[model samples]
Target: MSASTHWLATASIQSVLERGGNAFDAAVAGAFVLHVVEPHLNGPGGDMTGIFATADRPGEPVVLMGQGPAPAAATTEHYRAEGLELVPGAGALASAVPGAVDAWLLLLRDHGTWPLADVLAYAVGYARQGHQILPRVRDTIATVAELFTDHWPSSAAHWMPDGEVPGDDALLRNEPYAAVLDQLVGAAEGTAGGPDPTGTAAGRRTAGIEAARDLWARLVGREAEAFLARPHRHSSGTDHAGVLSAADVEGFRACYEPSATVSFRGHTIAKTGPWGQGPALLLTLAILEGFDDEYLDPSTELGAHTILEAQKLAIADRESYFGDTDVPLGHLLSTEYSAERRRLITESASHEFRPGTVPGHPPFIPPLRVDYTPPAAATGAKTGFAGIGEPTVQPDGETRGDTCHLDVVDRWGNMVSATPSGGWLQSSPLVPALGFCLGTRLQMTWLEDGAPSTLTPGKRPRTTLTPTLVLKDGQAVSALGSPGGDQQDQWQLLYLLRTIVGGYSPQQAIDAPALHTTSIPGSFWPRTWTPGGAVVEDRLGQEVIAGLEARGHVVTRAGDWALGRLSAVVRDPATGQLAAAANPRGVQGYAAGR
Candidate 1:
């Protein structure tokens, strides 16, 4: 069984599985297809984080660490010298080393059973032949048309050929990207005579994957460094050259690490380390674990209020302590600490940003900007440009380009949940040679000297790409995730509460109303927060809305189904039954299995 944010990715994974591939192989294939089909959401230049439990080690979940560090030149002094107060949300100066492609290749090399060419054929076919352009892709291009035409001509030539935005019905093809894939395959096959003259299939396969990895580093790094060296327009309305170099790309490698886990209601929930926002979800669960089952319901006024308050508390801590540095996670996720934090929740919504204190380690308080007014250039005051930021919820409760998620559970008990994001077409200017742009993930960092996530050389910016794995009785049972920047875990919390505590089916939990708090500082550029703010799907009911508003929550009622884009795959270890579900809201995500 497989579920993904796009139908094309899900269908591709289904084909891989049908052809006798394992969960890791299917996930790698689907992820590459997502880069081709969902260019506005993700690309090869992006980052990804995944958690999986193999059939041989069902009780142990491993995290795939694909997030790359800042380049050696990406220092705070350089950014501040440019007269920038914040990292531009749409420029190469904010770019991190590309990590998604290398990470996927690492997974395929270690755990997959298929050859490199076979795994990449699906994405190569789509990029070369063409796929129907999604309406959202066209809309995103329209939003940035002026920027592309005025400054990023490479982007203009690619996204808006002949100075016209492609219509929604157009068949979009990225022949350059297809050729890049072909080069990778060719590099692998070209090594047939080296190392192993006997021509053994396994030796050839191993040699091929290694060759492809080396070629990706050399080719992508060289092209990106040369293209982004010239001055370009940024979201800050300034022209600046990028700081990334080919050496930064060549020095990075993806690896596996043990998962940080916590038990909730007899189920062990697994997530990445504090470098990403995955720990915030575990902290939220720990706080909510102290409440009664009734208060955990998302449909009722009390339940909704309680959940929102709990989320705010967890996120406040995330802002203060969660980063790539040595976070004292041992105390943060402890039972006593959670109990102390839970006691701070009240019947009324709390507007203050309060982070719990850890013994001997003072929390770093970030700047709490309540509101943001974009510069005229970003706001279209000069050229009719829309606001630019990471694909997340706006202050008005409207969602823009976000991330992609996938979950696969094979019959043999192997399970994987992955969230691949960043490198949207709007992130930076197109690297014509690579047929995609670099990601602006460095915007997640702060310029302050003492913050844990302050921009520094050779350090990863705290990321939001988190995936989840659940286990019971020392066996992996489910894999799940979503694609809403900060709301990813918040939405998943509702599903877990519904299915585990409320006894709802997977589809029922997904189809139910969703909500999240915007009270914490955002992880993207122009970092800001809304005091006591909560956004909810209107299907949560008028009574619940009124109840939340009465409790001092500045509630925004998103239309009937505008909140979450979650998907999940489950396995019944006792019975060997497999099931899957996907979000119904965008009419895009799908789940497939037999």
Candidate 2:
């Protein structure tokens, strides 16, 4: 092996690991740096979610819980009361207490090997020096340049270095953000607060609710007051507010619980509530487990197209019915997500889309039932492995934001992957002088009325951000994930299936183009009134496309590689070899340590 072993990722995370910090620490640093380097992809404005397993560390791979609190401020009736067409983006509502920093602190407190200063340095240097805008970064800006320009002044300044959004090759710079990073680092460390960084009257403590509450936050020093004055405006295509304040920033806090739901291999693995989607992932898997590959394979094609349809069915359920377990929405078929119910649904799924509207088909209501009271029977096919008892109680509702990720493995058998972001920097409005985006993830639920994910006071928007790790025999096998909204979990799933079940190496898996199903209903059995539809390109092997057409999939071909960009690192335990790969398509980046 070369003197060091690393793979594709933002600079900060790699630097941490290179200096001896493990994946966890490196991941934290990488995420922070991403806030500055790829501001559009993530920052402190959104929520965070991730899971990891380490051979160098102890315990069954732990899930780093980071879904921020349901806004104590956005009440259920608030949405109804506000004549606002949908969830309001008022400054107070647009921002959630940022969890990325808190999550970073918790990770370091538990698994990190580096000090806060050490990790912050990577982001600091990148911000201060400013790198030339690479094609990938520039292209990403172009994708949502209009969105950023629509809201945050900082975004326009960053993306439009030349008064207009600069294309690739322009020397990009954000000195103001770098200055903010310096102060945030100082604040976290308690140094810049006018000689009493820990806020013992030595600091201003005059602005920002969250900042004043925590003595350590004084490290933000002189800039803290200025930082809080600006508010976050909504960045959705339409309908937004921008009244942010100092108290709001000071009041921000990250929430966590011991036992929310979690899952693995198509079953709710072991988890409980407060954290979002962990159980839902398992629920989808549980329902899928009932069908043997024989049934699944013959039922669908072998190409990416085949899996696309099945995945669409699962995601559709998630889009409409899934919500914070606290929602009080009744179960779909008795105790919601029961095994017997799943088998029945599966049996009918094959007959779905058989052309004519058949009377015997399972009704279209199960998947769409928002108020799933327990009248639905409970059975094994769907009842997942009983969830592990939760260890802590957390807040209800959820958070929205963006993040960044990177993973690496070395010759000595050390491997790591890190994803960090809780806000979409480029897509949301920047707090004028603070230099970061207040994520607008709440816009995900835009239905006219009563959508589960629709914005409510304190409720978190549905997310596509799930960082993941793959293991074999209780040892770390590989690490992978991305910053795509809502696309995060699906991308990881598609890549994992490609790597393990398809016999492809991790590189092959990361390199492959991907597809996704819509949040819609199905035409065949059980007649799922899905939230969306699934579209497979007419390519990716003729056989796969033919099968979908036969089964009646409404296909829409995307770019050669459409779903999202993917990056990963894999190591075979026995051989001690490392493989790293990155998606070279539109969502771009490169890899190393081959």
Backbone clash numbers for all candidates listed: 1, 70
Worst lDDT window (10 residues) for model 2? 385-394
Q: Could you give candidate 1's per-residue lDDT for residues 1-594 as a string of tens digits?
A: 999999999999999999899999999999999999999899999899999999999999999999999999999999988878888777899899989999998998888989888999999999999999998888888888888998899999998997999986899999999999999988877874467865787777777888899999999889999999999988777778998899999998999998999899999999999999999999999999999999999999999999999999898888889888999988999999999999999999999999999987778898889866445455554523343555355555332558999999987989999999988998889999999999888989998888889999899989988899999999998899999888999999999899988999988999999999988888876777789989999999998999999999999877898888899999998999999999998799999998
TM per model? 0.97, 0.71
RMSD of each: 1.8, 11.0
TM-score of 1: 0.97
Pull out the clashing pairs in model 1: 380-385
Model 1 residue 366 CA deviation in Å: 1.2
Q: What C-alpha lDDT values do all the predictions have? A: 0.89, 0.47
What is the C-alpha lDDT profile of model 2 across 263-293, one tens digit per residue? 3443223232322443444444444455554
Q: Which candidate is the best by lDDT?
A: 1
The global Cα lDDT (0 to 1) of model 1 is: 0.89
